[model samples]
Target: MDPLHAWKDDFRREVEEVLAARARLRTDEKSAPEEGFGGRIADLVIPPAGVYADLREAVAKLKVAQDEAAELRGRFDAKDRALEREREARERLKDSVSRLVLALREERAGRVEAQAEAKKARAEAEAAAAALAEARFDADHAAAKAEDWEREAMARLRGAREAQAQLDRLMLESDAARAEINSLTARLEATACRAAEDGQRAEEAARKRDAAQAAERAASARLAALEDESRAQLARCESLERANQRLAADRAVEAERLVSEALVRAEHEARERAKSAYEDGIEAARQRVEAAERALRESRAAEAEAAQKARQAISALADFRDRTHAAMDRLGERTRAEREQAEADIAAARRGEAQAAARLAAEQARRDAALEEERASLRAQFEDARAQVEEESDAERRVMRERWQEQVQALEALRRGFERGKP
Candidate 1:
């Protein structure tokens, strides 16, 4: 193959690469859809709460980041303008600078967005903390109310039990008194019947005594026996009255004791019930407190994680910015060296032509042609390298963005799920 053909082929290949690079640069300049931290933070919070959670750390970070970003952006812009002017002479290099500027702007915008997102996350955390605190306060208040209600109920129950016991004792005593009255009535009826029979016998004995003296003596003996029996019945009635009084006293004492026992039992049962209700209320409140505490802890953890992610993003942005500056510095050095070499070549060519226009003109023309070809080759290489760098940087940025999105979405989802589970 001819060397001219080979050189033409190489030049043609470089032109194709440059065209491809132009297309890629255009694509990279197109902005991707912006997913802000606000949306993610909104997803973290529930609908009922407007805002909660601690935000001091995230807010501080955002403030610092915003200030830093402004500084970096100003520096980047100044540097970019200088580079743009310096690269204006080279068509391929101009495109690279333009692409680098666009990339820098995108990186700054991404960093700003990440910092804003962290601030939003902090707001959500604050909202959650406020919600948890409110829950705890409400729970404590409810528990206190329940305890008060339990105490009041217990007091009422005590009074009711006392009243019920008094009533029970009175009923028992009344029943005992009624029983004693019935026994006394029956005994009186029996005594009256006996007295009637004895009177009838006395009447018969007197009739027989009227017939004879012996009958009269027998009637007297019968009268004496009847009198003795009357006395005995009277003594028995007195003894029965004494016995009834003693039984009444005993029944009263027993009834009082029974009432006391019943009252004690009732009081114990009531106390137990009140205590149980109070305990249940306390337990429920405790569970709510525990749940709220757990949620608060989780929200704190998520916020901290988001802050950490934001910090990492900022750190990565810083690193990228440093690399871009280093690349710009190296590009500046290259441009300077290229300018000096071109000046030297121009000087050497001029010297060659001036020294021998007739004898050295062909050699000088050949040297000029070789220098032009070498410059073309170098330009092609530089364009290719710059394009490759732009493509690699864009790819890395896209991958990092996707990873951050996935992680944020996952964390927000988990936080929502946990909140829903809380009572």
Candidate 2:
């Protein structure tokens, strides 16, 4: 045989053994022989009919229990499927959350880079302004040097003009030379004034350049500081990203663990349900067995009662037969006695016989009536016992159902709690 088939066969054999054990248990529950005055008498006589009826009822109850056990087995299968679905859902949710965390970290990094570039651009603009101011100052300084040379030339031209004027006063000087001197002096003074103004403007431009350079340096220093801050921020962001990744990993692990735990819990719940059903089946079977035993006991008691009644009837019949024989014997012996004695004895014997017959008849009637009463009593007792048993069974079933419902509710609440805790 194939291994699978062998395993199946083994399972079937185990089930069959269980069923056979149950059957044997039921068979052993057959009523203990009724023990009472009536019961003993019943053993010696014909049995009553009520016994069969009780047995039939017990058999019916056993069938009901078998059906209930089958139903519980079906419910176990459904619970197994539900638990598996819950585990799958939890795993999917955990994966989704981890991916979202990674996306968020990437977005934050992009923002930090953009902010750092803006700060660098602001620093460069300040440096360019400083360089332009320095170039303007240099141009002004060159113009000032050119102006000083023109001033010295104008001073020499002025001295030459004064000598010419002195010569004109002592001995008539030339008109052309005087005119040339005047023109040279005027051009020289104009150059010197223009140079002096350029020098002053150059000095002012130099001061402005220096101030601008200082401002540029200060701005650059601030920009460098900002760059350093950005670097630090970037580092912090990297750290935060790492931390976020770690947190995400931790969350994933935690989620997986939670899913695993939920799966375990679901499995545990399924097991608990199976166990509870098994226990319920066992308890129901036990109650059914107990009821069957009680019924059997009642049946045996009734049978014993019927047997006792039959024995009583047989005893009465036997006594009647003996009395009749004794009367006949007396009749035969009467001839040997005196007439008066025989007559009186015969009359007394006849009366005695009649009394015996009447008593026998009455006893027969009483026996029938007692048997009826006993049967009625037995039926009433049986009914009462059956009713009490049913009521007790019902009460027990109700209590068990309530307990089972409470357990189911608690399990459902636990399932809900697991769902709530899930990511």
Candidate 3:
């Protein structure tokens, strides 16, 4: 083929491509439905031209097309710059979204941590409540025990008083027996003297003397029996006193042992609980740190991927630059309008995101406040319960001590009374 013909054919193909590009741009504009300048640009139609008669004419037309293509290329470059700015804006929006997502994830993590802490606090509160209940129960049990001891002591006192009364009655009986013996001895002496004076009635006097002697013997036997009974009663009293002393000693020792055991057990449990809590906290902190490191790595990877995608888009746009010249001419005004709309849309989206973020923040703050308030209330309740338990325990102890003292005093009084009556 002739060289000129080949040139003409190439020129024709370029023109056709330009026309196709224009058609495609018009179609794109129609699809988007712009108005005013952008609309007019899209609506403008280029008529198809007939084939040129000669090479020179075709060359001149080709030169004109080249000039128009250069202008289009310049406009395409401007549009490309605008597209780059829009891409930057999109990248910023994506970064904002990523930050928002990261923030939401952090908020979720914080919420989980707070919930865990709340759960731990609740468990601690429950443990404290159980301990308080146990303490109250122990106090009640001790009080009941003390009351039982007091009742036993009182019963013993009543028995001692009755024994004392019995001893006094026995002593009175002994005194009467002794008086009778003395009177009998005086009567016998009188009868014996009268018999010595009256020899004629010696037989009657001897008989009377024998009867008197029998009566005196009977009186002496009765006095000996009374003396034995008194000695036995005194021995019984001494045994009872020893028993009372032993019971009081046993009770004191038992109370001291119980208190010491309770204190040691409580101290041990508290130390164990503290150690467990500290270990759990350290483990939780370590887990959180690991999770944070993992999240940071993930975020960095995501950022790098986003940057890679942006670079790929830039390379694609650069590749499209040559083909987009014809379409760029028609797209100039449309791009500006689209940019404004995109910016407005982005602003609206940003505003919406900001509002959502604010609402989430407010909700988070409110939840934190509520959790704090609940924690404070629980702490106060626990403290109050602990104090009440302590006070009740102290009061019970004091009461027990006072009762013990009273018992001791009563026992001493009994001992003194027994001593006074001893002989």
Q: Pick the candidate with the highest TM-score.
A: 3
**How large an RMSD does model 2 have?**
42.6
lDDT of 3 by residue, 1-423 (tens): 121233345658988999999999888778774553555565566544544346668778667767876565465466556656766666676666656555655556555555555556456555655655565566556556655665665565556566656656756765665676566556656766886777656566556556666765676676567556656665665666567556655655565566556656665665666567667766775676677668767876897688678766655554444323455455446656766886687688778867876876787688668767766776686577557756765776677678667766766776576557631
Task: List where candidate 3 sits over 4 angstroms from the true fold.
Answer: 1-253, 256-271, 274-278, 292-296, 323-342
- Candidate 2 wrong stretches, greater than 4 Å: 1-202, 318-423
TM-score of every prediction relative to native: 0.27, 0.28, 0.56
RMSD of each: 42.6, 42.6, 14.4
N/CA/C clash count, model 1: 11
Model 1 residue runs over 4 Å out of place are: 1-212, 318-423
lDDT of all predictions, in order shown? 0.49, 0.46, 0.62
Residue-by-residue lDDT tens digits, candidate 1, 239-338: 5434533443354344335434543554465456556655665576567556655765686577657756765664454443322345445544654676
Worst 10 residues of 1 by lDDT: 414-423
Q: After superposition, how far is residue 200 of candidate 3 from its true place, in Å?
A: 8.6
Per-residue lDDT of candidate 2, residues 1-423 (tens digit): 121233335557978999999889666544343333334555566556777778788677656644543443233233324333433443343334333333333333333332333333233323332332343343234334323433443343344344334433423323343444455445545555676667775565555555555655565565556555544544443454345334434543443354345435544654565566556655765675566557656865775577567656644543342213344345334322444564566577657756765675576567557655655665565456446544643564455346435534543453343324321
